[model samples]
Target chain A: MARTADVDDLVARARKGEPRAVARLITLIENASPQLREVMAALNPLAGRARVIGLTGAPGVGKSTSTNALVRAFRRQDLRVGVLAVDPSSPFTGGALLGDRVRMQDHASDAGVFIRSMASRGHLGGLAWAAPQAIRVLDAAGCDVVLVETVGVGQAEVEIASLADSTIVLVSPGMGDSIQAAKAGILEIADVFVVNKADRDGAQQTVRDLRNMIALAAPEGWKPPIVPTVAVKDEGVADVVQKLDEHLAWMEDSGELNRRRRARARDEIEAIAVTALRERMGDLHGHQRLDVLAEKVLDGSCDPYAAADELVEGLTESG
Target chain B: MARTADVDDLVARARKGEPRAVARLITLIENASPQLREVMAALNPLAGRARVIGLTGAPGVGKSTSTNALVRAFRRQDLRVGVLAVDPSSPFTGGALLGDRVRMQDHASDAGVFIRSMASRGHLGGLAWAAPQAIRVLDAAGCDVVLVETVGVGQAEVEIASLADSTIVLVSPGMGDSIQAAKAGILEIADVFVVNKADRDGAQQTVRDLRNMIALAAPEGWKPPIVPTVAVKDEGVADVVQKLDEHLAWMEDSGELNRRRRARARDEIEAIAVTALRERMGDLHGHQRLDVLAEKVLDGSCDPYAAADELVEGLTESG
Candidate 1:
């Protein structure tokens, strides 16, 4: 089959500030495909230009409201903002929820704002195969800040942290998961904590719980600030954004951003490597090499490691 | 440095039914090792022989206690059993603790029962890595059953379910994580559900809740029995054992045992093929290749998937 067109044209259009083209590029590769290869190739150059932040929590924790408010907040400052909300865990809808686009309509007319929902059907890891491409597309579009809001923690969304420069864990007051901030399985990955929906009754206690947990768990001198906000009212959101800037500033000041980005680069490399290796298991099968070696190892004719090493050497040398 | 003879000897001794040998083998590979290649080779033939089962939940959810009791239950029926208790999530003693042998002393003296604690240091998937080898040792040692216990939703433990013939998800009442059982990302993987510490309040409620949820969610026919058990007091351990035996029997009678085992063999083959690729990666200036690729992809000079596909094709074709 002929290779699909690279995302370069869409990127070119998007970079010209065409919102529809940008959204189309993201939509085209929102899942895994042969075309994702071309898109990712085109997208990589555009990354590292935007400050990418990730927001993640349980469903109905007001992540959409929080994300919408944040997008609006960034727009007020005349920044080109991109909002990519992840809804992968809701098994039925994939990750591209039409309702998400509806909620995002508040920013529809703003040429500075772009929103996309990444689907997780065949690719459960957020965008699965397409996420890195979408992020690249947005970056090329000159979005100064890109915010990714994952509706919940799943194998895919959690891995998103490895790619994010900064991660904000969204929690609510009455959710009974306050102390869970420490043991939320992904707490160790958070850079900032947002106590969304603080209008609820347990807001203060939730803040206290978060404070105590963060105080107890964070490495000495690496305290992550807990910002309380009623996102629906747009109250305290600017403060939340202010804290986000402070945290990013601290990451830069401490030389952590470069280190974290280096690690993120390494992780993406490994993930890609593993994926590629899985796709190429047949070369070892030709010449009846592995089958013979496997039989030998299975029967103790040769030591397993020696036989394995010999097989690799044989395949490589023969190659 | 020469590869350790200790790993090879310990694995052999463990396969020969030596408890101390099994314990030592578990401890040696529990940490990151350049020797994982040699050890895994030594372990390959011996793997895929035992019936591996995984149990997971929140901390203090009594996984160890339940595992200990389950082993005793198997012993009661004269079934030779091997228990691989995974304690690697956190350092019970700073990232390495192989103390389950001492804690499960009752079955320690019985040659038919081999218990080992796994401590994973750096390998993200080491839980599955160590497990298949350990289970192999037990299987070749003439063991009829092997149980692996882990906590929370982790990638390492999740791999166990794929390797195991049947998987059990262990949960307790008070933690209120039965909802976790419903949302327990691994619920789909469980063949049996055990509500441990059933003597506690809300045991019935936990069972009722799990059953209702299962009835709603389980496929048309399969409804995993949520066996209520006091694993500590041996209260419902017999029923669990009975259920396990019935499940195994059903599998054998229904031709599922052979079919599943054959599927596992294919997985074993695929896993070994991937491992072979990784070993080859170790030999190349892999770091150099990745760096070059990163630079190319960053500037959009090359696509990542194509680069990745090229990497794999180069290794296998040129190896």
Candidate 2:
């Protein structure tokens, strides 16, 4: 009950846009603290206001620079923004992405911006589940727009992109990035495509390739636009922001926003339920029981499915 | 009982090195068929004999060529080899990697060799869980060795590599691939490093970079050897195979093989159990219940964790 009061206080501070309170709330999420449920319950009513946008691409695609430009653009309109730079590769390197975070120092002293780098450690479902909670923190903290940037084209990146209201897939010219993006099946998730470093020699070809691909795989609604930019120089960024606004308007008008949000909430609730079930099973049976089952499966006394069935039965009974 | 007899007959045929039966069993795995448990139970006794080797790299790093070269090298010694070319990118393009799979036309006629390309669709745990069961099928089919080649540096690739007895990370010269690999945090999982395209420019630098990174990390026990190979020409392919054999020896002598296998089995069992629990919950509640709960969460009537708790209670009571 004391902790409940503290969580309420924290939520109040965060809702008033106190940077420390927001940071502390996210830390609770990252650590998966026991106070998390209390924190989420407190923050829930204040969220659902921030528009979430996701950016993803390969490592050297100027994602950080692009993110910085977007942050500046959003701030120019006096919009409060939050950035979550999620690195799926660096499990051991907590805060190892300080260099990238340093690249975002333009917003360090600005009260309107909150930039945090997160390492996707081996949590329950990795970034898929943790990210939405972090986004919720930013939303509850009164960020008008929250930007999520994920490195590389891993499944986690895809999942995070799906969670966003608009996902911008960044590609640099001359790297065959469009083809790589296509091969990685990232093209489908792109609500907006940005060809950064557009002044490069192969920029036309990159745009052409993307245009052709977009034409071929055009979905029923919301044909993703390709915007070329030199993000490092802060060129064409306002156009990206405009496109984002247009996409958000379209999403809201077409009822896609509500569907997407509901889908996201459904996934969030399911991930939590599954994680809780797993933890409960782990607490009840421990590794010793699973180890025995695994040994039996290995020795041909049982199949994995059969072992799993027995374990689930035990979990249900215990519950 | 009749289905069990059929599963036993199929397993017997697979054990006799019948390619059709092996393909059938793997098809069951790909589809997650109901007969999978019976097949796995029948196959488990015959597995644990074959060495499962994992090769991973960026797309143009010549992984398929390297796999082909290794298959040739292994077949020269009359060793039965099974290759699972897993393409995580081509989930919608089922069997769309026919071109790459066709490149192994050299071994297509050889009954001693079994090659299959797998697409890691949206399975419960994706490739991490499906791959092991597929490998078990190959292992039970009297294969002396299994080679799993995964594309890109995604988390799934890293996970699949960890499941191998010896994981070979291939990088080409002049691509900054070593740096990319290091950034992907895959350097720690390498049991053997193959510098493919060794004759290309900057080959020495790539090798040097990997050496330095390895030296810096310096994992204890079984230092991974860097092997240079021009796999397309089959030059140094035999050396790579030799290094693999040596790594296998080290793993066995160090008891690392058993440890890795047990760990893999444990993960497999846990994935299955979690999937089973999720399915049971889904069956009991259906999407309507989840949608209603999600609506409640979205409307601020409830938070995700609280909704999850209620769902779990429902699952437990229903069970």
Candidate 3:
């Protein structure tokens, strides 16, 4: 647990854009420190201003290169940027890949840019559970834009859409990337589509396939546009940024931004409440009540549904 | 909602191995019916007897064919087998892939075998959340063996491991299947590894790789055996079953089966309780308490953590 004065000093430094302060806050959140409630309390006044953007694609896609290009573009616009890269790989295998970090070396010395990598750690909800709190930390630290990059697989991509104001789903030529994207359900969450490695053969065909798929679906309030970019060479990077800007403007004008923020807040609250309840239940691990209920279920005296209801009622009454 | 008498009648018929009664009970669970508690109560005594087996592999890894083979083998042993195929694909895309159901047509006329496909329908925990109750239904319906098959992708595979007494991870040659399996964390959950396309060029190599990977891992209580099979021709299918039986024997002898069941029961109880709390919170929508707390966090008057605490306190008190 951190002391009250210590938390206050860290929050103040974080608000001043001290990189070390920002990093410490995130580490505390990751470790689930006892003083997290206090840290968030201190920083809440300065949060909720940064524009969060999410980038997702398959493992071999040029997500890192495109993210680097996007960072450079945002920096050129004189906006401070924060990057959170979430790796969905197993924790036993270790953290985010080294190549993803090395590719962003160009922004390493830029004081206006901050980059952090997060591993799944075998968490139940993949990146969704931890990324939102980190976003709050960066948002309070005064980053004008935050880029959340995740591998577009499983629940990680779905969670990214909920956390970000804009989501960009990237695909490259070949590798069944388009079909994988559709099967993973990224097509529904993508606010902007970026066909990376545009110089590769069949890039145009991939773009056409995506366009055809999007056309088949009934129109939503906004149509996602496909932008092609050779991220390695930074070709057409500006076009991707332009589309992002357009999407953000539309979100603002349509009041979708407020709605999204409200939903995000609600999700965060629900996650926290559920986590709290789980902790409380876990505390009763060896206690007689839960054990008795479980025994009843095992012995056929009661069903799991009935046992669960009784447990919930017990916890609420005891609390 | 269903009448108490109707639910009791359905449970009685299902316990007698009536397919329609079993299907109706599963449908009620899927729809989260009001009578679920009563139905579970009636069925609890008949469960905890069946041997649950989980089979998972990539989308094109011959899971359906292998599952079909395994069901045939079980039937030859005079065992009643129930198959639950879970599809993680989108529901609007349609129900379970017709090809999967078609491939299992060999068992369509078998009175001792039941095959059912479950589409994900955008559940929060993928197939895991619903599959457990469905397994209970099958177990109570007098099945000697229940085979749970799922595409070895996403969180569904992970959850399947927790539900089944034994988990078999399947792989075939080419298509980067081995690498995908490693990346998906199935390597850790596999109680038995099956190389399904044994005639392929790299089948032996795949087995060797899995064996080497298992050897590298610090030995747990059990060492998973690698079995080779060509499911389409029913070649080596008996070897797979032999390994499954050995694993089951080991689990029973070591008392691991009971421990796993207890943990599964705990997980179910927690999931249900959390879901109940979420519904309560959702019902609070448009209520002043939640809205006020969210507003406080959004306006920086309160942090999300504090707001969550307040919300939980309010909900518990009101309830």
Candidate 4:
């Protein structure tokens, strides 16, 4: 049987760079185990040490192709790379889960690259189960670069872009919806913008329109660069990578890096707290007579606010 | 000065179908006064009587245009229409907020049509501070049909969509991305889908791809129909309305309407409880010498989770 390690052992093994252990750890966290946040807290100090790059856009912006190409680019520098492509399970085919394995064929034998596809079941706002834990695993695996390829966002994808050290929003020519992106959170979230499919005729116009839109939307001094690429051919991958370096440098110089990282940490903490509270609601209720109180509040018998007030009041009064 | 009415008067005025009173009541609830939820409770029975339709998509998909066209179609039947447009500001705005206001000038003088733009002000999931109250106001305002126009959703928008009787996801014809909607929650949240700008050449392909995708993605029994339209010309608006009617019939025919509505109401009650708990966080901490507890938690001398437990435990132990 595959090793079924304890949570602490899993964390230790993951920290020591065991991919299997890391995967299990991610599953445990994503499933909201009773001890998940405690495990996360144990791993907290070790997190945020890795560079996370988020790739997102409407579907068909060549996000997966771009991710594959970027993996090659990073490997060319002899850097260990980790790829995470989130594929949602189809509702039909009796809950057919789209495994990313078929899409990332080349990386299977390459020990230097670890590619995992996640399912965003119950995923909201780009927040998927196990995502944070998965990110941590990659970080612990000592991967210098982690490329997160999302399930492509409709409007909710903003959540994915916000978590990355640098976010590249992919677009293409002839889509004719390039202008619409400026109005979406796409412009606000991108550290670098990529207009893929540079071979298309209207690509230049799309780039121009984007630059103009960014100019209008960008606060007077902050302008994110727009680059064109044919992701399938890996054309302009180097340029895209270089632009990312520039964006990171700019964020650091502008003191935005720490600010953003701190904000992300806070969001993580809050998300965990909220999730934790909900998870422990049953446990918490057992320690008190909450069910008794809640019933009274529900049937037009008493004020809910006052009942809630009594819960706290009773504690202070009796504790 | 605006007339300041109590919650009861406001509810009564709104129930009698006065737009001004409805707007005022919404303003009150959003402001988060002492009696907001109580007022919402009072108004709850009046809601769900109207057909609540939710419209969402990427920004600038002409969602508002489609909404307007649909609203006009409903109004032609002499049905009173109420629209809740979720704006970026809770009650104030500048720049694009102004642009948003400008685009919505057609019904500026219509009495039968009541329009209110709610600003969420970064409250994720796109809910206005006083949305439930606003919803009640619109419900009490005697609108036969109420359309909820989202600013854009990340996660909360998806959650909000569940509250609607019908949800139409609008998309443009020439999206660079292949997936009509990201395989995110939105893929499943939509009831009826529309690919706007049918005049565009790729519109048919977009619709076809969407139909094929939905056919593959939708669960066994609930396949949403995809409609193509030039919303600006009002082309296919009536068909869209007819499809919406058909969807309602399907829901009732399938025996899912009452179940879904009950579930949504239960969700509302649960959400209210959660929001109430958060709102009362300060109240729970009132004059309790919490700064020391907070300092200790921040300083890492005391665990944050432990501190919260201490508070909750202390509250109940006294009882």
| Fnat of all models, as shown | 0.22, 0.67, 0.58, 0.03
Winner of 1 and 4 under TM-score: 1
Error of 3 at A251 (Å): 0.5
Best by TM-score: 2
Q: What's the residue-level lDDT of A265 in candidate 2?
A: 91
Candidate 2's displacement at residue A292, Å, is: 0.5
After superposition, the stretches of candidate 2 with alpha carbons farther than 4 Å from their true spots are A1-9, A93-97, A177-179, B1-9, B93-95, B177-180
lDDT of candidate 3 over B1-319, digit per residue (tens)? 5688888899999998888898788777666666877888888988988999999876678998899889889999999999888756454323454644575578767778877766655654345457778888999999999999976665667778988999998888774745556667777889998888889898888888888778887568989988889999999999989999999999899999877887777777777777777677767744666677777788888888888888789778767
Each model's TM-score? 0.76, 0.94, 0.92, 0.75
Regions of model 3 farther than 4 Å from truth: A97-104, A121-126, A177-181, A285-288, B97-100, B124-128, B174-183, B285-288
In angstroms, give how far residue B267 of model 4 lies from its true place: 2.7
Q: Is candidate 2 or candidate 4 better by DockQ?
A: 2
Candidate 2 whole-model C-alpha lDDT, 0 to 1: 0.83
Clashes of 4: 15
How do the residues B123-188 of candidate 2 rate in per-residue lDDT, one tens digit apiece?
766786688898999999989999998876767667876679899988888766555677677777
C-alpha-based local distance difference test score of model 4: 0.65
On residues A27-98, what C-alpha lDDT tens digit does candidate 2 reach at each position? 787777889888899889889999999999876789989999999999999999999888776665444446
Q: Can you tell me the CAPRI class of model 3?
A: medium
DockQ of each: 0.25, 0.65, 0.56, 0.18
Q: What is the DockQ (computed on Cα atoms) for candidate 4? A: 0.18
Full ranking by DockQ: 2, 3, 1, 4
- Quantify all predictions' global Cα lDDT against the true fold: 0.66, 0.83, 0.80, 0.65
For candidate 1, write residues A95-172 as lDDT tens digits: 255665686679767888888776543342234344556676788788999898765543434656766778888888
Worst lDDT run of 10 residues, candidate 2 chain B, spans: B92-101
- In order, the TM-score of chain B in each prediction is 0.83, 0.95, 0.93, 0.86
Ranking by lDDT: 2, 3, 1, 4
